[model samples]
Target chain A: MSVIVTPTTTGAAGAGDPTSTSPAPGAAPGAPAVRSRFTRGPGRWVVLVLVTVTALAVVAPFLLMLLNAFKSPSDYSTNGPLSLPTELYTQGLTTYWNQVNYPQKLLNSIVISGTVAVAATVISLLNAFALGIGRVKGRVWIIGLFLLANMLPQEALVYPLYFFAKQVGLYNTQLSVIIIFTVIQSAFGTYLLSSVLSTFPRSVLEAARLDGASRWQVLWRVIFPITRPTLSVLLIFFFIWTWNEFFIPLVMLISNSTQTVPVALATLQGDRLMDAPTTNAGALISLIPCVIFFLIFQRTLTRGVMAGAEK
Target chain B: MSTTTQTRRPHRTGTPRQSGQPRQPRPARRERSYWTYFLPGAVLFTAVIAIPLVYNIYLSLTRWSGIGTPKFVGLHQYTRLFSDELFWTSFRNSLAMIVAMVVVPTIIGLVLAAVLFDYLGRRFRGSVVSVLRATFYLPQILPVVVAGIVWGWILRPDGAVNAILDAVGLGSLAQDWLGDPSFALPTVMLVMVWVQIGYPVVIFMAALGRVDPELYEAAELDGAGWWARLRAITIPQIRPETYVVALTCTIAALKVFGPIFALTRGGPENTTNVPSYFAYTTFFKKLDVGYGAAIATVLTLIIVLVAAGFMVFQARAERKDA
Candidate 1:
């Protein structure tokens, strides 16, 4: 690594006088002259074009879906996708609502995602608090076990969990999805939160303890306030993860009424290749909550990253 | 003052031990408490996750159809998999996608982070970076079905990509992206990249921020150009994070079922049949529980090996740094 550092200084000195016969300091005899790649005129434009092209490529599908949601089925099928919709359409929405029971499914998704996020955050926060701040023994082993549990693929567990859920009579229930999502997410949450908490200054915690605060009270009053931003970031992340979860819900939630948005939208495709507009509408509806959350919590998300950076 | 006063005045009272000896250890109090912190998490982990992982290994060894009693068939499924053409094909496709999904996106993410970090100042950088990140992350937040539907519409024969190609008078280039066997896996890989790039970019940005500004200053003084500085300073600084992202992306790529299930269903002549999707079909569509378990077991092993490889690499890197 240090080998490259000297070349940089030589390159700078070389830039000052292109005709200089003398070797610059730190320059090896006959070393190649370093040039400023950033100063190359066409490269900047090329990078700009590349960034724009990549952004458009990434965003185009989403924009198409959003626009298609506003087109009638006939218009969507016949008209060019890039063209303006001939008429604004609510028919797709109506079809989506009726076919997928969109309202009920949306409610189920919200309830399941919400419950899972809350439960996972709470449980992980407790674990993080105990292990992070409580000076608990064997903390490294516990954390390692959590990581091991997380790394196991979901498919590996689906069959056994199916039987287990059935044995416990929780299969095909929203509770099953909630519990499954929560358990899977808690490991990640605990890891992130513990890292955040360990960075917290110990003197503040000690002050609380000396002031006659119990462990729980100190956690609630002191640690919670300090870590609120990290907690919120985790909350949004967990909510998004649970909302977007597929395989667990597919394996466990067997009935239409209990099906979340992903499963509901997936079943919409079977035997209905022509129903693009309605399926697009369902897809759009499924995305709105997450988009809203993203827009709202974007600050905390970046700040959390910045915090992790500082560590 | 309090400590001295207590030591001087406390002996006026009760027990024999209070005068001369130190107190006994608090064994009674320790015994009174249960290990409650481990209770809920441990139970859930063992029941929901751990047991199933163990059971999956067991199932991989049996010949059960998921209905009746299992016949003990040791290594039969494994032996069959050795000659399974579809398994190898899917494995190859998975390896291709892993490269596409992890390697390409990671480079793109690092470049994007570097560009944004260079171009934007601190305050504006923070806000703008998040907005940009949110755009990429939006697809990931949507259910795979939704994303699949959206991408399907965009990539259909006469869909958005074709429409754009037609509009630009390059109609010759337009093809049925998802329906074409040559294009199906690539299309799915593109979607996976689109869905995943935001995460790694965020991680990279975080890692980039940790890099000391003095290093950049030193590089500048040394006449290091942007690319040179990036190669020497930035890449090495973010190597650990890069490893983490690569490991996670590989695991995610291996286990990718939802998008494939939603979009291709391993179709266009099974060009996109990854091991996970193959396992899904084997169990659900074929009702071959043991075969499916064997595939799943292999995938689990691959992920574990990749993770271990990363950890070992990271440890070596750290040792060199030390």
Candidate 2:
């Protein structure tokens, strides 16, 4: 995501000096190359077609799922798997939705993942402000610790977390998964934001502080407004991740009524082996939110995907 | 990335005028107390991850059924783990996943990215690349449960793969992909490969954008073929991205869960069991909490060490480059 640092208080205050608070320009080793027009040919068409086919092959499963979700079970079994449905069928979808308590599971997913995204963004923003802009003592060590924590596999932590959740009486509830996802996700959020915010000018904070602003005021008024792009990127990631998260919810949310969409769909998959259309419908339902989010925020999502891998 | 860290080091720790702090203002000093800003996140972080990590270590030393109380039996679980045939099988399967998920995919991704970025980049519209990248990355974005279920449908005996095989007059080649002991692990690994190749491809394409076109042009002018340019320029230029992709992919390979849970459920005599799934089944199904924790602990230790190794190598490489 592009870090647009708008000077909210004073647009004229060194606004022309782009380098004042901008993080180092990302590693662009060269300008994009111009292509010779003559590069197009029969040979290029072959390569283009091959790449197009590969792309289609990769996305074929998704298309197939969506298509099959519209078919009757008998139609699915009798017809070619690749064929279009003779008629749109909502029976399987309606049944699957009721079977999994679709509304409850979807709401649980939204509430849990939404809570995680907001909470993680806030916590990490504040933490990153401290470490990145506040320049706290032992900041390097703190960042290192966060990096180490981020490295641990979720599997290792979940077993003990299960017991811990039970001890604290958050077990089998949405709050339990929400808290865990927030904490786990914020570690990366802190790392990414801290690195970006470390580039913030001390003069900016001091300017606000000299006006008798509190720490929170300076953060809210000065630093945060400029970093909203990064925060939004983090929010999108945490939302998508917590939404798609399966393992933790599977272990923690034991009750079917409390389960998230993915967990509910997985459970349905296990029990409904003979019900292909219904299973496909459930899978389609689980995929819709993510697909919609992706379609809407493709650029930002792609940027976030590359941002973590950049360093 | 290196530049940001380096430039921030000297000016990063405290306020700008704190070098000779004999006359520092009291208010400024008080305002610099940023530790409190860290407390909330730190507290929650400790509660959620750090504390549980320590508790997991302690739990690994005992034998418990996850019911009443864990019985302290020092290293017994670890000792038994080494002799357990299933654990080794799972561990081996996890390693095999590294080949399918990490090694093969990394190669495919790098090659595919190069072809897209260097070859087709000039001829194709930019949207072509973007749309293609999105398509490739669909598997990574789709819930693993959905990917697993879809693949399950595709690979069933009367499923898409067999339907295609029969259509192509290779009916003898069709088989029960997930149910057979011999093909179960490999089929699972293949699906994983499909799911994983997208990530590296997308990341590698981004990395390629940062690589200087001049270097490739210079190499081409010297009569270097595509392979030569890829070897001498693209690979070295994208080494950091390669390392990051490799490290993350290996970690992912080791910790695979949802696909196994959804597709095979570690079936056909545990052929497709990975450590993470094994840990899950042991803790939940078998009710062996301590044993599960031990398995998870070992898995965590391996992941940590491997990650540490990558970091150290990156550091040394940076120093050498500098």
Candidate 3:
């Protein structure tokens, strides 16, 4: 597992150049030296094989689901999974739509996710601006508290939140889900935004202040434009997170009418295991919006979220 | 009032000099008012985060079911947890998943980053790199339930995987991927790896970008091979990133719940029950809130301990370097 092979050959090839002439005799001049380094005769094949196997392993399951969505139950069970369908089928879609209440569930998910994203983004902006720009006292303590809150698992807080929602008469409502998600996500959003804000030049804000702008005007005019890219990134992320969230929706929204896509999908799994195609179709439907969202915001998503440690 | 304001302007400007010269009289009045701006945010933070955090800790110690008044149960839930085979099994499964999720993905990510770094360099790199990263990260942003459901269909007995296996004339390899006890945990771990690979890839790529190209040039001049340069320069340069990814992924692996909940539901003789799911089941399904809290509290402690260990190790390493 821990093979330590010397790369002396490649080194030798590099130093053999007449211009360098500093090292060993076997060194070659200016040729892209290939030492059969990790990707040697068999290692190349081995690595390729592993990558192919892993890719297949990753891709095969989704492909299977996609194919299963087009197959009849009898066809799926009797025929080999890899085999061509005996005939085309659409019954699965109809079954999935009716059984899972796909339209209503999808609508609920979109509304809740959109609301949460917008609310979280707006709240985060305000909080970030206040903390980032305003010379508030105890700023460190406030930011530290938010960071600590982010570290706690949502599971630990969900129960009390549920009770709190019930007490406030927002239980089983989309508003309740939206509020909870927004508030929970705001902690992290504020942190990210504040970091971005910190990177903004203080001199720009000072100039704006000297221009006779009020505090609100300075935030609106000077700060908001510069932070649009960061804000958009946060919006996309918050949207995806809220859209993909499962546990909170599962716990809080027990009513079938209020169920989001994931909760609805899970319910379908529990209730309709017998109908493989319908379940597959339901799962596929759930994946569409996320795939689209991902495609649209892929750049910002990766850059904003992963760039921290990447740097 | 206008006359007084006109007279006070000169005194106001003079106040700073008087205070500086006389050491501290009028300035004390302004200092007392400084706390006012902090009042709102501080209060909101305490109300939303601090109170709830304390409540969660308290809940972790109690016997309150979702529907009822609480009873005090001193360490009984914890002691019972020690004897619970399911808890231990889930904990072990989580540990295995962590190794699979963190170690495998980090290696794959590093290799992918190296390949991209060599191929793309800088120009036109951004677009291709972003697209690939997004594709890989797509699954992670999807709800775990969705991921589980989608993968479940793919791994079904006659699902996509088997279809491909049969098509390729290697039909013997196909099995009930999620349903079979032998394949369930590994199957979940693989899905996790696929969903998770993109995050580390982007991270590694960013780290790779920061590496000075001159080092590679110097290494090349020194007759260093690709692997030599990578081992000597690349790995050490990105050590901080590696630590961050490892710690974060480990915590994520331990807390995994949704995929297991959606796909296996800990089926095929309870093979895929991770600790998070175990706690959920014990609380909600089994209606043993106290026991579940015990499991959750233990899980939290484990995470905290691991995180603390990483921080301590990192600090010591940094100190040694210093």
Poorly placed runs, candidate 2 (over 4 Å): A1-38, A299-311, B1-32
Give each model's whole-structure lDDT: 0.71, 0.79, 0.67
| Model 3: CAPRI class | incorrect
Candidate 3 lDDT at B89 equals 91
- Give the TM-score ranking, best first: 2, 1, 3
lDDT of 1 at B266: 89
- Report, to 2 decimal places, the DockQ of model 1: 0.22
RMSD of each: 10.6, 6.2, 10.5
Cα shift from native, residue A278, model 2 (Å):
1.3
Between prediction 1 and prediction 3, the one with superior DockQ is: 1
Q: In terms of TM-score, how similar is model 1 to the real structure?
A: 0.84
**Any idea what lDDT model 3 has?**
0.67
Q: What is the TM-score of each candidate against the true structure?
A: 0.84, 0.90, 0.80
Q: Clash pairs of candidate 3?
A: A11-B223, A12-A27, A13-A28, A16-A27, A61-B154, A64-B160, A81-B163, A82-B163
User: Is 1 or 3 the stronger prediction by lDDT?
Assistant: 1
Count clashing residue pairs per candidate: 5, 0, 8
Which pairs clash in model 1?
A8-B222, A8-B223, A8-B224, A9-B222, A12-B223
TM-score of chain A of each: 0.79, 0.83, 0.80
